[model samples]
Target chain A: MNQRSQAVRDLLEAVRAKGFDPGPDGPPPDRCWHEAQVEVGDPAQYPSVQESQES
Target chain B: MQVGELIARMEYEYGYRFQQGDVLLIGVNDQGMGGPQAVLPIEQATVEQQVQGIHEEVLPMVHRDYRNLIMVRYEEFDYHETNGFHDQFTASLDDHPGGFEVVAQYKVDQNRQLYQGYMDQQWASPGLRWTMPGKLPDVSAQMRELGYKEPASSEAEYLRSFQPHPEPGFQPLDQEQEVSHLNRLAPRVSVEVARHALATTASTESIEQQAKARQTLGHLVAYDEDARDAVAYDASISPAKKDALVETYRQAPAKQRPALAAAAGAAWMMSGGGLKAGRAIMAHAYQSTRPSDRALVTAAEVATTRAHMRPEEIQEAFGKEIGTDLEAAEAAHQEWERLYSSTTTQTETETVVETETVEEPDQMQLALEHQMNQPPAPVASSGPEVD
Candidate 1:
């Protein structure tokens, strides 16, 4: 699974484990979640967002 | 003489046996001012006679305020009985505006009277009452076994859970779960609102500030129907007045209105209100968000004052605040375990200090002893220090 999917799975697991309802019946996460989508990419393909310092 | 001797003496004097299941009458007269008397029946008597006897006995003891009388049967004098026993009958020779009504022993006034023939004691401190419907399994160990990441810390993990998608692929619970979660959070959220009104704000000592707090609470109730209904249940405001207040709140500007509503809810709670209103406010906040979202805004407000509290302290506070909400307790327990395990692992990874033949003193204790033994430092001189 992609990293985001894994994260979502873990969340669902935690909620169920805690005996809390996942939503429609439970509270939504604080962040805007409906906008999220699965992305296809390789971690090594993208350069680090942080700029390298001059030696 | 001991209490037993005194009791025996009274029993002998009154020609009555003072024992369990022996019904006694305690009555208050017409004026409702002084002590109505206690009439103990030495011989078997009718309920009517017992009540009449109380009035007759107390008439001499009290000033003129005796017209109607109420009788309560004390079935047993046991300590436990006094704690929960509450069944009484009232008899009046003339019409009394309010008749004797059965009030829960817990709800009785300090002087032992009901509030307007209305007596219901439904609320209890958190840990004392179980809030959830059934038993919830302990899944932390199982989850950990599955290699799921344990929380790093209690408060952090709790707050993080409220963050959007803290756990990837996390799905929201169904409608029933939502209602249950909101119900469980109701009391705590209400208390949080009160805490915010009294502590989160800059000041509440001034009359203007107090008035503003009250007004804010008013707005909160007005903004939501459930909250409004709760206030109506608790407060004696007329329907028309309640409608007017709600209308005004509706007309108010949207800018910073949420804060005002919260403040108003707190004010209501502070002013001898809150039982139902607080629950409504929390439920309203819970409903405003989408199913997949965390209850961050409201949860943060509830958890704000507890920012500096430790995990154990937070758990204890929650226990005291809401009693035993199974889900909340388990969540806290998991947080504690995660923090504990991580701490232990870190300790094991660090190097150990050297051991010597001579026993080493505790560094902290040694420091304290040395400090105690040392002479006081010299006061500084006005002139420059000597070389």
Candidate 2:
């Protein structure tokens, strides 16, 4: 019933182990708001191509 | 955190003003990392840009690889405390799986109210627990796992969850139950009848019958009343019930709805027993989800309204012979014509009979005329004397 797949559960566990609180009690701290999903790939791999095209 | 402060923060972070109608994309990945990824002026963005920004860039970030792109038209962004401060914005979530779950909150002009996205899953209300179980049964458990305290169920809630139907016999419905019935039956009832039921308190029908009718009608038309009698409609009944009804109506067999709608419409009309009840009934029938039935009901409603004819009259004229909407409408018109013609013909026949009776000479006048034509009366008297 929990739509969260095993991958999501594992990610949450990893985030928790890394000292990132998922705020099971209430909302996470302001610092935690937009960091729930960390980027796994390198940003350099997908650089600002749109910006380069514009330039 | 007021509206002004939130807007300023958004502008500072995004380096763009999310003015009314500005398009923004918010992504939610498996790890739940999501924010406004791109902001573009709706006027400047093409269909392609919107699709890519939402589908390609944002949707992939959702918990599943599936695209659940949320689009917001920057209406008003604010901050509010609902157990915690929220940075909320009011916007249309384009093509949301749930049709138009918009949360447009306002207080004074520029008050601070945290922006909670339009989705109910994002809200912190305890009522959400009650509603979510019916929609996403696992959602409440997930929320509990996230450490939010689930509110204890109240006595009212316990009763509602375990409310038993009366044993076969009729029982009157209280206002709360009436509201429940109205919501449950919305999609199955005529929109006109449902609207009438909710808007007015002048019905002569029993409360139980009223509740059932309201429920059936409400179920048919997807009518939800925000305020009923004196109580807040939302507070009286669980949104879960309404959501379930809506979902059921959506998933119901499409082919059978028109037939059910026609039946419900007829029942409401009979209950009302008014001269133009058929019009209301047919109008409600016209709300059928199927296009063929909808068009037919519309034509029938028009014909009924125009000629003051009932469905019975149409049936009598056509005798199950009607097929298309045009034919039903034509039948109604022709039925009226036949009625009018028959009345006129009877009136003309009566007038002719009366005129002939009046113009024919009296008995005395006939005798006098006969005498004048033949020396008849005097000759009879003299012949009698001679004999």
Candidate 3:
């Protein structure tokens, strides 16, 4: 791979280390575009304000 | 790779060179090191110059922290139509590491109403989401307020309340009991009775009462497209009212046209001289409505003709319209077939589904049975008759 492609791979690795699976390669399916309900990134890091309010 | 490297890669791979007024929002909360930071693009600069500017201005703000970093860009998009400017923002994070995922995409009209964006229910943490802070400063403030406290209602609901409610009591009729009652009453009422009532009430009743009567009649014939068409085309109704209805359907937005086409089709059916006439009126309407656009007229004629004729017969049918331009006719036919054939098939499928779902009781048959079972009323009885 070229420099930019390698850089993207390295970025993906760092994201994976944060306990959030970025899913399989080549971007999530197009259905994940708009109105997708899947929780992305680390839920622990980006905690819901609703959960905070309830607690 | 670091955030700076990732930004460079995005420019190289996606060919999206940074433009002036584009802002990058960096969110970092690792090791208590960072809050939110905004990076503005360098004006009238080369790619290298902009990258150098970003390195100088933005890198130090994040304190060289790459982990737990989220980057989003707010880009101004001009769609080149009426009130078409919008601020489109996309985020690159753990979930969407390969490329940026569109987060907040909306446009504000002259009235400051928002349109075209995903709902909060689609997001796991809607409160944390950021809108365009540069163009719509109030929206950003509202989103931040939402992060701290519960909102009374969604932004969409607030905007929707301003629009005129076309059909009152439309929601209550969704209940099983209401629908069943309507089904029982529907067949007993003739189209002539409803039309006569509306015509008479148009002159005598108050505006509010007339509106209510129209709404009631509309609901009564809602399930029967043919009955609705008959009412619309009735001779007793004023010509101006008919013209107004046609104009309203014609001026409806393209996205709403599919739903409103039933009303337009009713007008076409009456004016076009029914199914036996075979698309000549539709062709005439298209020609008259948009005479300047030859391609649109050709496409509409082809689509309407194709609905009634076979593929082999389309050219013969089109001989009257195009007059020996076989190539152009073939091109228009192919284009419209590609666009509209699937839509026609889908509509037919939906009709079958609707027919299966709504069970209509035969009121005429039931009335006949009741008359057969009951005793007849006394004829010519001026006083009590002695048997």
* Winning model by lDDT: 3
Which runs in model 2 stand beyond 4 Å of their true positions? A1-55, B1-192, B195-215, B218-244, B247-289, B292-387
Tens-digit lDDT track of model 3 for B88-142: 1222122433332223333333333323333355556443322332222232343
* All candidates: TM-score: 0.19, 0.18, 0.21
**Predicted model with the maximum TM-score:** 3
lDDT of 3: 0.30
Model 1 scores a TM of 0.19
Cα displacement (angstroms), candidate 3, residue B258, comes to 6.6
Winner by TM-score between candidate 3 and candidate 2: 3
In model 2, how large is the Cα lDDT of residue B88? 25
lDDT of 1 by residue, B1-387 (tens): 221111122222222223332332222233222122233422355445544443333322222233332223323223223222122123242333334322111111222221111223565622111111212223346434533344333222322322222122211223464334434444424332322222212232344333333343333332333333223222211222222222222233443233323323222222222122332333333443322112322322222111212212222222221222233323432332332233333332221121111122322332443456531121111110000
Per-candidate DockQ vs. reference: 0.01, 0.01, 0.02
Comparing 1 with 2 on TM-score, the higher-scoring candidate is 1
Which CAPRI quality tier does the interface of model 3 achieve?
incorrect
| Clash pairs (backbone) in predicted model 3 | none
Which one wins by lDDT: 1 or 2? 2
Error of 3 at B9 (Å): 63
